[model samples]
Target: EAGVAQSPRYKIIEKRQSVAFWCNPISGHATLYWYQQILGQGPKLLIQFQNNGVVDDSQLPKDRFSAERLKGVDSTLKIQPAKLEDSAVYLCASSPRDSANYGYTFGSGTRLTVV
Candidate 1:
C-alpha cells in the first residue's frame, strides 16, 4: 500500500520567521489531515480535508497559519511569523474515509523548530 509522503524532514527558523511543509497523500484516499504534535502531548488535528474542500479547521490558528489541498491530492501548510511555542512536529496523514473503523497512514513528519 502506498503511504503518505512529506518533505523537508526538518526545519529551523527564528522567531517571527516563516516556514512551510508539504504532504502527498496515498492514491485513492479521500481524507487527508494535518496535525501538530508537541512533545509530551498527543497529536492535535490542525486541519482535515475531504477531497478538495475543508472539512475541519476549528483548531487551526488562522492568524498565522494556513493550509490548502490542491486538487485533493497534494497539500501544503504554512506558518508565518512563527513563534517559539510553535516548535513541534507537523504530521500529515490520510485515510480512505473519516470513519472510526478506518486507519490512517502517517508520514514521518516535518520537525519544525522556532528559535
Candidate 2:
C-alpha cells in the first residue's frame, strides 16, 4: 500500500506571508492527521480528521492556522501571516482507524522556512 504524499518538499517564505501544504492519504484510510515539528522538538499534533470530520485540534494555533479534509480523502493545511515561529516541518499522516497499535504512516513532510 502507498503511504501519505505531500508536495513541494520544501518552502521558504518571508515573515507574514501565507503558505499552504497539501497531502493525500493512503487509499481506504479513514483517519488523517497533521503535525508540526520544530527543529529540535518532537512532532506536535496540530489537527486530526476522521472521514472529513474534525476529531481533535486542541494544539492548533487557530488564529494563524487552518486545515480541512475534504471528502474524507485529501487534506490541506494553510497558514496566514505565517510567523517566524512557524518555521518547521509540517507532516501528514493517515490510518485506517484510531489505534495506537496500528500506528500511522507519515509523509515526507513539507519543510517551511519563515525568514
Candidate 3:
C-alpha cells in the first residue's frame, strides 16, 4: 500500500498571499486528518474526517485556513491571506477506523515560509 503523499514539501510565500497543501492517504483508510505543526511544537489536530464528513474541526482556524476531503481519499489544506506567523509545516495523516491507536501515517509536509 502506498503511504501518504504531499506536494512541494516546502513552500515560501509572502504574507497576505494564499497557499494550499495537498495530501494522498493510504488506500482503504477510512479516517483522514490535517494537522498544523509549528516549530518546536508537537502537531496540533486541525481537523478530523470520517470519510468525507467532518468528525471534528474545532481547532481549525476557520478565518484564514480551510481544508477538504472531497472524495474522502485525498485531501487539501489552504491558508488565505497568510501571515508571517502562519509559516509552519502542514501535515496530512490517516488511519484505519477499527483501531483506536490507528497509528496515523503522516506526509513529510508542506513547510510554509512567509516573509
Clashes of each: 0, 0, 0
Error of 1 at 107 (Å): 0.5
lDDT of each: 0.95, 0.95, 0.89
Query: Model 3: per-residue lDDT, tens digit, 1-115?
Result: 7889999789999999999888889898999988889999999999998999898999988999898899888888889989998888888989988365758888788889999
TM-score of 3: 0.95
Q: Report clash pairs, candidate 1.
A: none
The per-residue C-alpha lDDT of model 2 at residue 60 equals 95
Q: What TM-score number comes out for model 1?
A: 0.97
How do the predictions measure up, each by TM-score? 0.97, 0.97, 0.95
Output the worst ten-in-a-row residue range by lDDT, candidate 3. 98-107
Candidates sorted by TM-score, best first: 2, 1, 3
Better of 1 and 3 by TM-score: 1
Error of 3 at 5 (Å): 0.4
Pairs of residues clashing in candidate 2:
none
Per-residue error for 88 in candidate 1, Å, reads 0.2
**Candidate 1 overall lDDT versus native:** 0.95
Cα lDDT tens digits, model 1, 1-115, are 7789999999999999999999999998989999999999999999999998999999999999999998999999999989999999999999998774898889999999999
lDDT by residue for model 2 (59-100), tens: 999999999998999999999989999999999999988776
Q: How many backbone clashes does candidate 1 have?
A: 0
